[model samples]
Target: MKNYTVVAKDSFTVLGIGTELRSDYTDYAGITKEKADFWESIKQDGRLETLKAVATNNYIFAVNEAVNNKMMHYAGVMTEASVPEASRLIQFPKGEYLVVKGEAQTAEELSNKLTGIAFGQVLSEVKDVAYVGGPNATVEMGQQNGILFGEMWIPVVRK
Candidate 1:
């Protein structure tokens, strides 16, 4: 069984470069590819590195949100600093959050695994809290013993 917890968090902001995903929300493969491509583009062009230079920590955040009724994804960092290349500043409110933690062989795998477990298993099985659909993120905290580890943070309201 997947392990998860509900935790309280203070407000935070992430500076990011984003793309509006064109794939249907239910098309997991398509959305994954789009997010992968977006990450590759940001890395290849040094946007990710630029963000990292000003980051408060080494953690990388992959954020998913809906804006103007369109599915949007972002590669971001927790930073108070702003860059001209950033497409948006994502705001996560102060509230309870559904936090799912896990590890994988790679950052990509970690993201997919955490996302799947959080959305497919944890959220569906858990009671008392419900995700209300704000900007949720898979935070790539770091690696240990050659394994990538992180947590998925989804804002939720107590039901």
Candidate 2:
């Protein structure tokens, strides 16, 4: 059995990353890797008072808390305005997600794990809601490798 610990998440600010069809599932590695690299450089370059990291796949971005200020394109997941297309509407359902934590000291490590897991297991959690289609996402805060780690949230629909 896949082991998952149930826990309540603290409400945290996030960057809701969106991508067009061309950007979805395609060139995910190239695009996300660059973003993660850029974010990581922010600290070393002294652009960020605290370090920030962002990892991306074609459909999602795993971003650090320091990137919170750069978060935009929020489909307002916290608000009711983000309902799916009217004709495409279904019961607004939420799921029991298997949120996972990982640590990658550098941009490459973080990017690889995120992109791999994103298209691998997390997509398995949500059944029919645009795994390949463009969707905004949530990424939160955590710690690992004695460094700040980010938590990626994949909103799944309950069975």
Candidate 3:
């Protein structure tokens, strides 16, 4: 069984710099490439570092959400403060969340692994809750033993 847990969480806001994901929803490879490219651009341009400077903690958040029928992705941090360069203040509603944890050699691998496990395996097996759709995130908390570790948090509703 995939290692996961459902937990209650308080509402929080993430300040982010975002881009609309243009790939078809069914195209996993396209979507993954778009996300990877976006992250690379942000990192190279110092956008990620700017967001990190205002972060409440060291955790870096890569969030996905559908906004007005458009697939949106963000590189963000948890903070009440805002930067003029930020694209949005994404809000995560207070609720139960399906949390999937994992670690990998790189942040990119860790995100892909956790996301695959969460959607491809765990969400399908869980009987008591369902993901109703909002902003979901892959939180890159830190590194340990040269490995990147994080958790994917998807808000869920109990069935």
Per-candidate TM equals 0.97, 0.45, 0.97
In model 1, the runs with Cα more than 4 Å from the true position are none
lDDT of each: 0.93, 0.38, 0.93
* Candidate 3 wrongly placed segments (more than 4 Å): none
lDDT of 1 by residue, 69-91 (tens): 99999889999899999999999
Residue pairs with backbone atoms closer than 3 Å in model 3 (clashes):
none
- Distance from true location, Cα of 71 in model 2, Å: 12
Clashes of each: 0, 0, 0
The stretch of ten residues in a row with the least summed lDDT in candidate 2 is 83-92
